[model samples]
Target: MTFPVVGMVGGGQLARMTHEAGIPLGIRFKLLSDTPQDSAAQVVNEVVVGDYRDLDTLRAFARGCDVITFDHEHVPTEHLRALEADGIPVRPGPDALVHAQDKGVMRARLDAIGVPCPRHRIVADPADVAAFAAEGDGFPVVLKTVRGGYDGKGVWVVDSVEEAEAPFRAGVPVLAEEKVDFVRELAANVVRSPHGQAVAYPVVESQQVDGVCDTVIAPAPDLDESLALHAEEMALRIAKELDVVGHLAVELFQTRDGRVLVNELAMRPHNSGHWTMDGAVTSQFANHVRAVLDLPLGDPRPRAPWTVMVNVLGGDYPDMYSAYLHCMARDPQLKIHMYGKDVKPGRKVGHVNTYGDHLDDVLERARHAAGYLRGTITE
Candidate 1:
């Protein structure tokens, strides 16, 4: 009758939500947080304030955990290897996690597998960037830091060589890519177990504002059935190819010509799948725990015909709790999840999920609640 213990490195909101999912299953969730105030540290009973980059700290945290996973991918890869050498299980091992950690590696690997992606190159210097732009789409290219970039921080739309210098300041290799002429962005999420069992959730349409996710809608609007299936297949194929256990999120771009191109990869419960918490038959967090533990996965079916999730960004109004009464009174269907974090402008402090049989109604409900919480919408 011993319940398995799962240790998650990094104490962000993802770990917080994963802890909530583990509670019902009676599984133990341990946190290796950088600070006592980190999102999950405030709630989880077992919290270890340690730097994930330190191999000694990581080894100490994994002492009794059955499996080690992550809330973020910034951990030193060699530290993960050290844990594996100690006979501890690391779901989506360092080999698989590297592709998500380094954009350059991700692109090269995807290209080798013939996954549809925009043309890209690893530039040694700014001049190499210019050469890539000259040979490819020419000017207005996207430049990204090969490692350690998230949200909108490390991405740049460079129309000229001068515009690309900022990204190189981090001393990381720069990845130059053709700026995709996409009509919209999409995401396909899947989970795989160690036994090779996997499940793909319905494709979702993700909206971004300044490179940060703003909202997500399940079963993307106007998506052709064939194209949706293709995206799912591509995501599932990638999980198998990389031997990725736990969750895998494939960010994609839908071109004007109706083709879907791979955009990015996240080997954890992603913002795009946040709608699953209340909209699907089983939440992504629950399945992530099951997958990493090598248990049978829960069904990925949607409970409602349409589900829309809107991110609540921190704004001038710091006390979002005040708006809760109005949001719930107006729409009891709204499910609001507020992370335990300080309010900072443009920070993702929480999100709202709305589900129903009608798409437009659910979309409006989710958006309005999120907007109200951010103080962008009055009444």
Candidate 2:
């Protein structure tokens, strides 16, 4: 039987990239976005403009599609449950998606499952933070809102009681976690199908600036073979335990002592795995679509010895086209993917990926090309 259409809830860059993947599978991607200005709307044929919370809008957008999934984890669990009640197939259903939506719940669940995570608590008020810091062994813990936190927003580092008052007054519950002293951060991207088939990509090291990811290096240079296997095994274990279908991205921290700790979870295609687009035999976007549709998963083999991806943060760049030309002129192997959004300071406007031998050289070349794209470097 021929496959049916796939409906995506958010039309951000993830959906945009997924649309590119679905095209080759002969599967149509119909997106429900807020406006035509959304990143995916520019490239896809079926773009529905509406609010994600509106059932009428969702019902309209979901018409005739065999399966419904998300580019983001923001869709309310109630909304997804409602669709399931009406016989709509929701990949990585509400049960699994909830683990990504609420950090408090996720931490609690993972702790019960024996996953190693940072010391954390659900704080009702800022005073709880002060007491925790005073009573606990660690000071200056990380404060994160239980929900709606992303890209460094809704997160804070509090060293003293004075730093906790704002959240207390705002009536927002928070998760106070002991700050981890780690050597580096890494992410493992794993995908699963409804039939229990799973595949894991190479563990990638992420470079961060102010808690935002700036670049990713696949297979994490100089990483031990044992560590790579452990990362992949942990990711697969989480996926099976959570019964996660579609994609599950586990962000981990390698502590100073060389142990890996789970930091965060994402149930969609993630920024950390963008290098898979050009570096892997099958891109993550493609695998996610296949998983949601219950199609056979593809191999997650790397295309070359190394792959480096650098994020393009928006800055004061006048002629981005000229910068693009410069990158192509200097390094013809670089593949650039830019979201069609107006540039602003610190926003992720695009990314550039380079795949070849020599991990260090690939990373340096990618960073230099990205600097040009950001108008930060002349050559």
The model with the greatest TM-score is 1
Instruction: Report the lDDT tens digits of candidate 2 across residue range 222-277.
Output: 78889889989999999988889998999999999988999999999999989999
Per-residue error for 70 in candidate 1, Å, reads 0.5
Q: For residue 66, what is the lDDT in candidate 2? A: 86
Q: TM-score of predicted model 2?
A: 0.98
Model 1, residue 289: distance off in Å is 0.2
Instruction: Give each model a TM-score.
Output: 0.99, 0.98
| CA lDDT for candidate 2 | 0.90
Scanning candidate 1 in windows of ten residues, the lowest lDDT window is 163-172
Candidate 2, poorest ten consecutive residues by summed lDDT: 164-173
Residue 374 accuracy (lDDT) in model 1: 95
**Cα-based RMSD of the predictions, in order?**
0.8, 1.2
